[model samples]
Target: MVVLFVVAASVFGLSSEGVRDAVDDVGPLAPLVFIAFSAALTVACVPGPLLAGAAGLLFGTALGTPTAIASATLGATAAALISRRFGASALDELSGRRVTALQDWIAARGFLAVLYARILPAVPYNLVNYAAGLTRVPLAVFAAATAVGCAPRAFAYVALGGSLDDLGSPEAIVAFSVLIGMALVGLLFAARDVRAARAARREG
Candidate 1:
């Protein structure tokens, strides 16, 4: 199902340019196409940063950020749902003892776990969604954290996309570095927590 979603998204994205041109030739369909593609990309695990950036690039900030939020939220929700349904086998296969132990710690931390995973870029977005699904994290809390935590990273991409004129310039590099730094900090914290948990587990 995940593979299917990715294939579908790729097909849709490939035709996006033609679709946009068609909408321009016709009328009133441009926004619809943008929303649909954004949603599809999100569901397909194409990466929120890339999607947000594309949204800003295509629509500009005023329209782009809102569109990104809407489409990304929908996509993320759908992906979580799908992961909830088909995640058991894949998760069990991907996660070893260490990962499972880490998940246990996350369950203890609840919303904070979700928050950290959402904030950190080291964790694959799809994997986090699936991992959360496997735990007892409440849907509301999961959605809230995902929505809020995703904003900073998503907005950064959208901002960059909106300013494509500065692509490859020093400012763009600095902006990207800052975003990566923030993500790394969050990841480092999570890593520390994981290490502490492992030590405690070994001791106990």
Candidate 2:
């Protein structure tokens, strides 16, 4: 995680001009590097939003969106596996009730939970990945949902970043608006689930 953070910070610090220069200089390698950095960032718990935005700024829509999705999915899967192997007990100890509720919810709707969590920005990406690891959700299901769920946001970021020529352009504003709407919808569903779980627990 520490290593991941360092890599992410370095990537995030690149100036827009620097990013464009690097892309021009390195050409094809830029997407590969961006993907690698994005994976590391996700593992380090760097915010997904930052990564998505950076992908756009660095690679543009054509390459950035796919790179972000692939990197994020891989990073998330790796994090989930590692958390399950080494940090499950610790996580359970720290977030017992919430974890239990999440576990139950995942069991009931494993794919949907993964999809919703990925789609929404309400919960940190790392937390959701780790939580899924602690649950009994199938790996294939988790991976598939994660890949699909991350697409919209990833594309949005790439689109926003690609439109940098006109910083305040209608395209950028529309993309940002769409991202916010998706995030809000995800949060609403998550909140409803949490509330239902709490109510059930109280009733029981």
Candidate 3:
């Protein structure tokens, strides 16, 4: 993993401009290629933020946001399904009353739980996918929540990517500010929800 990160960093340079230049060399098919790569990377536990930024740098906000969202959703869902299939034995071994109750709660509020998880940066995207798979949350609910929850953050990253060349401009400043605000608000809400859930669990 360390070697892979070093290699990727060396090749990609960890900047929107570098990614843009790399994508531009591919011409018209860049979007498709980037989206494909984003999906693959998500499964490999690569952070979605970088891919979102790359999409923005490669395609700009208008095209980039939707592309990033779609690619991310697809990748997360794929990971969940794969984990469900392959990790069933391990999951079965861990099953118990508390686990069943938690699963029931998540299954009942799957969309909201997932939405909050995605909205808050606390939940790592790859980890969330595998976690959801371990529960009984419906795939459709998981997909929907992930799509909705991931949009704001994805947009923020895309915007940042789109504004990379003009970071000093008002557009870039606004984009950065918006992303920060949304992240904070999401974090606050997620914390509140977690507290409430814990209280309820204790009472039960």
Candidate 4:
């Protein structure tokens, strides 16, 4: 779905300026439309970073941060719920004792589990959503964790997007620096967590 959208956008010569113009033309309904579009695209596996950047490009950091956060929260919740409902049996079939233990741990600390996953650069947003669905974590807990955990990266990218046209400017440079820093921190944590998970699996 995302690939198709990208292809269509490319084929049609759709640029950020075009998207910005269209979003602006929508006037008062722009925020709602943007949220809806963001959620849908995200659920379809569109890259969250791209969407966050686009939000910044379209609405600037002040509005884009919250907009991206809200959209991502909504999208993650929607995917989790849908996967839980439709894929429960498949998930059960795939689950082993080790998987069950992990699920139990997540269930016991669902919010933190989701928060950790959301902040991990190596973990894809959609994959976390689907994986969380297989756990006993409540939707509200998952959504809350996603909102808080996603904020920093979302803000950084949005800030970068807001300053895209002036990359040499102080604000743009700062935003870019912050974005790289966030990615590095996230990647480090992600690598650590992957190692821990692997070790636990071997011990099991």
**For residues 46-155, what per-residue lDDT tens digits would candidate 3 score against the true structure?**
88877887677778888899999999998899898888888856877878888778878988888988887787766677899888888778888899999998888788
User: What are the TM-scores, per candidate, against the unseen true structure?
Assistant: 0.67, 0.75, 0.82, 0.81
TM-score of 3: 0.82
Q: Which ten-residue region of model 1 has the weakest summed lDDT?
A: 1-10
> Clash pairs of candidate 1?
none
Q: Which ten residues in a row have the lowest lDDT in candidate 4?
A: 1-10
In model 4, the clashing pairs are: none
Summarize candidate 2's per-residue lDDT along 27-68 as a digit string, tens digits.
677788877878888888887767777777777777778988
Clashing residue pairs found in predicted model 3: none
> What TM-score does structure 2 among the candidates reach?
0.75
Q: What is the lDDT of residue 107 in candidate 3?
A: 81
Cα misplacement distance, residue 7 of candidate 1 (Å): 22
Tens-digit lDDT track for model 4 on 29-119? 7877889999999789888878887787788778888998999899989999888998877877998999888888889998988998877
Q: Model 4 compared with the native: what TM-score?
A: 0.81
Candidate 1 lDDT, 62-162, residue by residue in tens: 66677777777677667777776787557768889987887678668877778887777677876776567776566677777877777766666666665
Quote the positional error of residue 84 for candidate 1 in Å.
1.8
Candidate with the greatest TM-score versus the true structure: 3
Off by more than 4 A, model 1 = 1-33, 87-108, 168-174, 198-204
Count of backbone clashes, every candidate in sequence = 0, 0, 0, 0
Query: What lDDT would each prediction earn against the true structure?
Result: 0.69, 0.76, 0.79, 0.81
